[model samples]
Target chain A: DVKVTQSSRYLVKRTGEKVFLECVQDMDHENMFWYRQDPGLGLRLIYFSYDVKMKEKGDIPEGYSVSREKKERFSLILESASTNQTSMYLCASSPSGTGIGQPQHFGDGTRLSIL
Target chain B: LAKTTQPISMDSYEGQEVNITCSHNNIATNDYITWYQQFPSQGPRFIIQGYKTKVTNEVASLFIPADRKSSTLSLPRVSLSDTAVYYCPLAGGGSTLGRLYFGRGTQLTVWP
Candidate 1:
């Protein structure tokens, strides 16, 4: 089975703290993504990488950054955690190509809380 | 990316077939319709994907019209476990780098 592993299932941080969320996929997929899900706003994309060291901003990229040091690992960083940033963070990966019809496999998610 | 609109919620009972429809009026020519289902505490799972006509797999079916303006996801014989939030997203924006935007999604509730 294809697996996407997130470093933490739940994380809590104080305001002004820097945060890191790590994701690793075993499928060797070329595309990796990070999204944050809120209660009624739905899942909003934060960042995505098409190749190692290549990253693009999604619709909502403010206060977030990403790193793709290796093919299988992608990391999301929070420069400064804020209370409004508390949400469920999801990591996903898919095969290389235009996502036209390609479905992404997602990790269980990391619920991050900022106080 | 083409924007998708769906119902806020739907209700169905066990053994009943539930259909969730999504509207993407601005879908481009190269775009494809995809659906994802997310449970209460887990990440979203892929349900089905289609470009046009009908496509069925072991788990669900996707019905797309000729105009590509809308698509329906049909889930047969629903049970309590079938309850989840279903999202319809389109792969459209100009770049082919696997970028997809998601909407609020439809919340389906299957009653026992």
Candidate 2:
């Protein structure tokens, strides 16, 4: 089975602080993604990495950045956390860059709270 | 990415079949339809995927028409614990590397 693990399940940070959410997959998948889920707004993509050192902005990438220095690890960075940034952050991974039917395997998710 | 449309919410009782439909008018030929189920405070779990026709797994079944414009997810004899938010992701053609576009999912509530 493909297993994706996040660094934290619940996190709390103060305003203007830096936050880092980590995700690791054991399936050697080439794709990884970060998203924030809010009530009524749904899950919005923040960033996605196709390969090492390659990143792309999604619909809502503001105030968020991603790092994929290695194939198995993807990190989401919040440079200056704010109350608005508090959300349920999700991480997912899939095996190749060019398959339409591959279902993404997700981590447990991290609920971040900014005060 | 193709945008998808689904119901805002649905209600069903245990031991009854549940069907949820998602509409994707601009779906491409190479695109695939996938569904995920998410519980409160947890990440979404993959339910089923299909390009066309019908595909069935232990958990659910996916039915796609010839036009591939819309798809239906069928849950058999659902249990109370089967309640969750179901998201229909319109995956792009070619590869899975494309970022999935998630709309407001359909929240399913199962009653006893």
Candidate 3:
């Protein structure tokens, strides 16, 4: 089974603080993604990495960035945390850039609270 | 990603079969219909995927019509643990890297 592990399960940060959320996958998948889930709106993509050092913006990328220094790790960075940034963050990894009918396995998720 | 429409919520009882339908009127020929189940406070878990006709797995069965405009996910004999938010991620095709877009899912509650 594919294992995607997020650095923190629950996190709290103050406004204007820079926060970092990390994700690591043991499956050596080439594609990693970061998404924020909100009530009623569902999960929206924030950023995704296709390969090491390559990143792309998703639908909701404002105030967020990503890092993929290695194949197994992908990190989401919140430039300045705000109360509105509080959400459930999810990390997912797929086997390849174009995984035919393959699913993106996700981590348990990190509940981030910005005060 | 194709737009998908599903029931906002559904309710079922233990030992009863639950069928959730999702409509994707604009689904492309190459698009694959996939379902994911998410428990409270957890990320979505992959359920099943299918192109057309019927596909059955140990977890669930996927039924697609010839028009491919809609799909049905059938859970046999659901229990309380089967309660969750079910999402249909009609995946984008080809070199786009199969990125999936999720809409407001169908919340399914199972009672004993």
| Candidate 3 to native Cα RMSD, angstroms | 1.0
Cα RMSD for predicted model 2: 1.3
Candidate 2 interface RMSD, angstroms, 1 decimal: 1.9
Question: What are the chain A TM-scores for all the models, listed individually?
Answer: 0.96, 0.96, 0.96
- Please give me the DockQ of candidate 2 compared with the native complex: 0.67
Error of 3 at A102 (Å): 1.2
Summarize candidate 1's per-residue lDDT along B58-108 as a digit string, tens digits: 889999999999999999999999999999988753575777778999999
For candidate 3 chain A, the 10 contiguous residues with the lowest summed lDDT are: A93-102
Which ranges of candidate 3 are over 4 A from the true structure? Answer: A97-101
Taking the tens digit of each residue's C-alpha lDDT, what string does model 2 give over A29-60? 88899999999988999999988998988889
What clash pairs does model 2 have? A98-B94, A98-B95, A99-B95, A99-B96
Identify the candidate with maximal DockQ.
1
Per prediction, the TM-score for chain B is 0.96, 0.96, 0.97
lDDT of 1 at B6: 96
Model 1 residue A70 CA deviation in Å: 0.5
Clash pairs detected, candidate 1: none
Q: What does the lDDT read for residue A28 in candidate 2?
A: 89
